[model samples]
Target: VSVQLYANYAIGKDVQAMKAVVGEEALSSEDLLYLEFLDKFERKFVAQGAYD
Candidate 1:
């Protein structure tokens, strides 16, 4: 799920879903590994558009 979400966000697929998930997890979690994964996802990928 995490990887899929990350990929989707990075590639500009399901952005609303990704944003919702990120918001939800970011607001309501203290789990270190989970948070780390979110952080990694945020930093590890960038979505590029047709115009750059």
Candidate 2:
């Protein structure tokens, strides 16, 4: 699989991109599930309120 590279990094860009957004706490199952739920809930709220 082809990988993307980030600026000034030994790792690939795709890896860096993923790393940049996530944190150590997110490694936990509870944290991950909570984040996923919040993300989906926020998106729905934003979509509903976009025109208001």
Candidate 3:
């Protein structure tokens, strides 16, 4: 679920789901953790090369 959300939010560049996960008030602990993991995943893995 975390990876799917990351794929949608980062790879697809769609924030609706991420914003929904984050909510209007603030980010929850789990969401924060998932975001952290997503960041690391992109930094460490997804940026291997460029694509059109």
RMSD (CA, Å), each prediction: 7.8, 12.0, 6.2
Candidate 3 structure, TM-score to reference = 0.46
> Backbone clashes per model, in order?
0, 2, 0
Residue-wise lDDT of candidate 1 within 1-52, one digit each (tens)? 8678765444443333455667544543434344455456666544445565
Segments of candidate 2 deviating more than 4 angstroms: 1-22, 50-52
Q: 2 or 3: which has the higher TM-score?
A: 3
Local accuracy by lDDT, each model = 0.50, 0.43, 0.58
Q: Rank the candidates by TM-score, best first.
A: 3, 2, 1
* Candidate 3 segments whose C-alpha is farther than 4 A from its true place: 1-25, 49-52
Worst 10 residues of 3 by lDDT: 8-17
lDDT of 2 by residue, 1-52 (tens): 1122112122333333454578544455544444454455446643586485
How does model 2 fare in lDDT?
Answer: 0.43
Candidate 3 structure quality by residue, lDDT tens digits, 1-52: 8668656446323333565766634855555666666667667667767552
Which segments of candidate 1 are over 4 A away from where they belong?
1-30, 46-52
Q: Which one wins on TM-score? A: 3
